[model samples]
Target: MKPTGNTILVTGGTSGIGRALAEAFHARGNQVIVAGRRQALLDELAAQRPGLVGWPLDLDDPASLRRLADAVRERFPALNVLVASAGISRPEDMAGDCWDGFDAEAIVTTNVLGVLRATAAFLPMLKRRPHATIMATSSSLAFVPRADFPAYCASKAFLHSWLQSLRHQLRKVPVEVLELAPPYVRTELTGRGQAGDPRAMPLDAHVAEVMALLGRQDHPRGEVLVERDHARRWAERAGRYDATFVAMNPD
Candidate 1:
């Protein structure tokens, strides 16, 4: 939350938003450890950036998450910031008879359960720090569901509620719970070529805005919503929830 100087662990740090934040934090003098499922990618990132630590982790596996937490506590005792950015998004056809090809279960496990387990594992260590931050990468779609990715949107909605409760419960503690609701950004989370999509916000530009918001010296709120996402952010408050939902998912 302080922007720099603290040891931070970022899940899904191999690509997309996670990777951008990791690089930015590393550049700002934070001891950044990037955790991802790909060892080669992590190694490459570490090699490319001096002092950037890479740790291989599988968020879907509870054992792997526990091991990662142990390793972090033993290796980086000063770790105080955690970015739970690991997630999966896949299209689901409700009209289809069979669910053989759909990834509903995997999406829920990775997005919801993954965040819960990771936070549980690292929370004790975080609480010990003088100042700590737990940031989860929810999506703007949480407020407005996308028909094709229903499960993904629902998972983020669950996170929105969970994070609010977590933040309130930890209000008296040194830990800070933050939710990052990103708009449709140029990222590979959807699939290949998405990072170059004209409809999506450029990854660098999104990260710049995110960093600027986080670095605010005045008052930093628990939720980080960008200007581009204002329409989705205010859908319910503006009495356009029904219209926005229909517009977001025409299919």
Candidate 2:
């Protein structure tokens, strides 16, 4: 949050927005720890960057997060920022004959419960710092559901509401809470093809905008929203919710 001189831990830092943010912070001379499930990727990233620490983390497993918490507490006692960027997305069609709750459960598990767990694990330490910050990634679709990805949109919607209460509760604690509601970005979150999708915003481009936002402290209501995300994010306020939902969900 300070742009530099703070220790930060970024979950899902092996790829996508998480990796970009970790690298951006590392470039700013912050002590960065990238937590991910891939040991090899973590090792490779750390090998390429001397000060970028990579620790194994499995968001679905509580024991794994516990281990990560212990490691961070012992090694980086000054950690003041947590970027809970780990998440998954899946398209589901409830009308399908094979429709079940499997994909929905996974989405809620990682996007909803996982974020809560990560926050619980690090919030105490964050509270100890005078200028601590908690940032979690949501989605622009949270404001208006995408019919194809019902569960994913719902998961992000949950975070959007949860973060408001979290920010209010922590307001007096003086720890800033930010919700990063990114628009459709070119990433492997949905699968390999999304990374090459021409319609998706470039990963680096989105991260660049986000970094600029962070540096400027331009977030309103602790929402670090990019320009592209504004339309969908404020669709309801703009009297365009129904139209926006139809546009995004048109099959």
Candidate 3:
């Protein structure tokens, strides 16, 4: 990724890390299109940042994703970057007697299926470009699972494996597959006040570090694990997987 001069499309651009990344890229002189389910939020983001384009998209809907791909191909043929950042996280209590409140299906549908569908839709277009990048937002929990958000962590784990394979298959091509494993960041994904938690990293700082990593030309790898996440990012390799898992999900 050349940092600038590429047309980029970022899903989940309405809020959180996605929005921050879109804005950062836009600031660097790249033409950015922010796509999300909520038209109002997209419009607000567009309003707040002039020249930032907004496109309505529903990652859960296959038709919507296909339409988005077609629209992108027609509107921005030069688009060389696809950031599949849209995701959902929900707390699940397995101890509960009732299964009605569990959100495993929804989490898998959005986080896993959504990324697969979106990538499939845009892959052809991406392949046509001289050079392209496909980036997905995984989580550090993929390496070290969190008890509260079981499905979310599992979905990201799936991404870790899938993206690794995708990178291998596309190694001979011009496409670059990148997985961004973020630590617990202050974001509204889990509800109100989560973004302000002192324990969670600030959104801007996370984005800055991520941007810096992406800006590197010599950094050639599948995963982008930041400094804060380095501990868990290599927990298994560092011979501390069991300890970290127990610590992260204490009874």
Candidate 4:
């Protein structure tokens, strides 16, 4: 995507990387729309940034997504960039007797199916634009797995593969499909504790790097990866998959 002058919509644009990106893009002169579940947060965000829009969205609900699509088409017909930044992360222990499929189901619903559904909803408008971009957030764990977070890792892995096909199919449509594989960042994605974790990359630092990467058009083959994401993202190709997996899932 260009550095500016593009209308953009970011799902999960309430907190963490999503909000940061929305703000960054807004500062760049993009017509920015921020969609999320919390009305209060949306209102607050819009107030903070003059032209930034805040729309309500619940990715797990089909009807809500349909409403978002209709609104985007009506309000921002020229919108050419979509960032599927909405996702949930949870740790599930399969060995537990009380473990049911609920967490896994929820994770899949929000992280995997959510992006697919959103793409379907907005692709028509995107296709109309001469050039469009669909950027979805995957994870460094997508290339490997954390045994404790099986479902979460699997969901991201699915996106890593699915986005490849999407990129190929959208080639004729002239839409660029970008995948964001981020390493552990100081975000409340997992829990509030994560926000203060020194081991995790600082949220602002991560977003700055990503914005810079995009500004420089440094993404190779449409994968927006920062330096820290390299080891996990290429472990398999580097013949370190087993070692990485073991390290990430220590006994």
- Runs of candidate 1 exceeding 4 Å displacement: 100-102, 217-221
What TM-score, over all chains together, does every model reach?
A: 0.96, 0.98, 0.97, 0.98
Please tell me which model should have the higher TM-score, number 1 or number 4.
Answer: 4
What does candidate 3's lDDT look like per residue over 185-218, in tens digits? 9999898678879999999999999889888853
lDDT of 4 by residue, 115-203 (tens): 99988888888888966999999999898888899999999999999999999887777799999999999999999999999999998
User: lDDT for every model?
Assistant: 0.91, 0.94, 0.90, 0.92
TM-score of 4: 0.98
Which candidate has the top score in lDDT? 2
Query: Considering summed lDDT, which 10 consecutive residues are worst modelled in model 4?
Result: 122-131
**Given candidate 2, what's the lDDT at residue 237?**
96
Q: How far out, in Å, is residue 216 in model 1?
A: 0.4
Please state the error at residue 140 of candidate 1 in Å: 0.1
> Which stretches in model 4 have alpha-carbon errors above 4 Å?
none
Candidate 2 vs 3: which has more lDDT: 2
Comparison by lDDT, 3 against 4, better one = 4
Candidate 2, superposed: residue stretches over 4 Å from native? none
Expressed as tens digits, the lDDT of each residue in 1-251 for candidate 2 is 78989999999999999999999899999999999999999999999889899999999999999999999999999999999999999999799899989999999999999999999999999999867999999999899888889999999999999999999987789799999999989999999999999999999999999999999999999999999999998899999998888887786
